[model samples]
Target: MDEVEIVVAHAERATLRVGDVFLKVDVDRARAEAEAEAMALVPVPTPRILWHRPPVLAVAALPGATLGRLGGPVTGSPTAWAAAGAAIRQLHDAPLPSRTGRAGRSVAEVVAELDRECAALVAEGILPADLVARNRRVAETALRPWTPAFTHGDLQIAHLFLDGDRVTGIIDWSEAGRGDPLYDLATFTLGHEEHLGDVLAGYGPGRDVDLDVIRAWWSLRSLVAIRWLATHGFDPHAPGCEVDVLRARM
Candidate 1:
């Protein structure tokens, strides 16, 4: 008999593991639809879809462990990280999907939201005002316009599965869409800046990537995500956590 294990449970979503199948239950049907659609469009390896019902999606478990966890040391080799980068490059180069719902934000909208979130962080006294302000300034570099590409909007390290030096699968496509390519790169390398060179090497040459903008996105993303994590009962202030990532920017 397959015993069910709760993988993650939060207000917005929950995931369960039963034997070889992983079940994702989302509060938002649109998000579930987008995830399914994105997974179908990406050229890279992804979990095989088993079935779907409204609000619930099931996929077969992929082989191997996650690439790494946030705020923790990455156990995967540099070769694996490079392979993940190449996979991302392939995804970005693929034809744009038509049903990219709510995929990206305008520069002005992003800046405005950043300001709002920064104020909340200050008011709540969750982070130092100076640190927030400095990072906010750094985030300005990412506000300029650029050519868009197919992006896994939330490409965190833990979402990638690896087997040896190869990328076995990428998961959690709820935020996939047509967006800034650097955002995906920045998200993947967040808190793991040491592996950026490996990723870039596999991402290949001739592609102009602005390091400053990537760093800025790192700052902006961490600052914006602090409250959400806290509200969801997750710690952002732990060692090497999002808060630490922001302070490290100094």
Candidate 2:
């Protein structure tokens, strides 16, 4: 039987795998365009763009499995994680994409959005009020200004693919843009905090990164993402899930 896997399905977009091709369906044309353009600009390995028509994008699958999955133990070795980090650094050092307007979100605007989302979560009783409030306070540190670098705005582990210690490719460029460098690092290590040192080591020396701000992003992202995940029919309360990630910050 031919295999077909639903990679992700959410309000914004859906990604499916059929045979060796991955198809992405996005509701926003601009975001899809940005992703196409960003993939072209990034220096790191990326999935080959097979074709694009309106809402659907087709790309050839890359070699190797994902670096890890959310709410699960990382199967990839430390070397693979380090390789992924180095790849991220390489992308960060690359020149920014020409049209990055879609990636620009001011800290103030993000905080405002976070506040609104947090309020919704509290009102809906989706999470404990104190847990949400505590993480909200912790998230405030990441609201400061930063010098923008080319960032994979969503650098979750699953987006990174590796073969042994070699990084084969990175998938999901929809959120790629000029943004905080630490945001990428933070997002990459969201739930997998223990492996951060390995990533930082591979990120190499002399790059100034604020660890506290990175931690702040971890808190902010998990808290803000819970409602969206639940709305998308994902279980945020699973063991080692987003909710547990927030609680770990307490």
All candidates: CA RMSD (Å): 1.2, 1.5
Judge candidate 1 against the unseen true structure and give its global Cα lDDT, from 0 to 1.
Answer: 0.88
- Residues 105-136 of candidate 1 have per-residue lDDT tens digits of 78877878899999999998878889999999
Candidate 1 displacement at residue 240 in angstroms: 1.0
Number of colliding residue pairs in each model: 0, 0
Per-residue lDDT over 1-250 for candidate 2, one digit per residue giving the tens place of the 0 to 100 score: 6698998888889999999999999999988988898899899999999999979999999999886677986787788788888998998898976654422578778888899989998999888899999999999999887877898888889999888899989988888888888889998998888999889878997577888898999988888888878878989899888898899989
> How far off is residue 124 in model 1, in Å?
1.1
Residue-level error in angstroms, candidate 2, position 221:
0.5
- Candidate 1: clashing pairs of residues: none
> Which stretches in model 1 have alpha-carbon errors above 4 Å?
101-103
TM-score of each: 0.97, 0.95
Q: Which residue pairs clash within candidate 2?
A: none
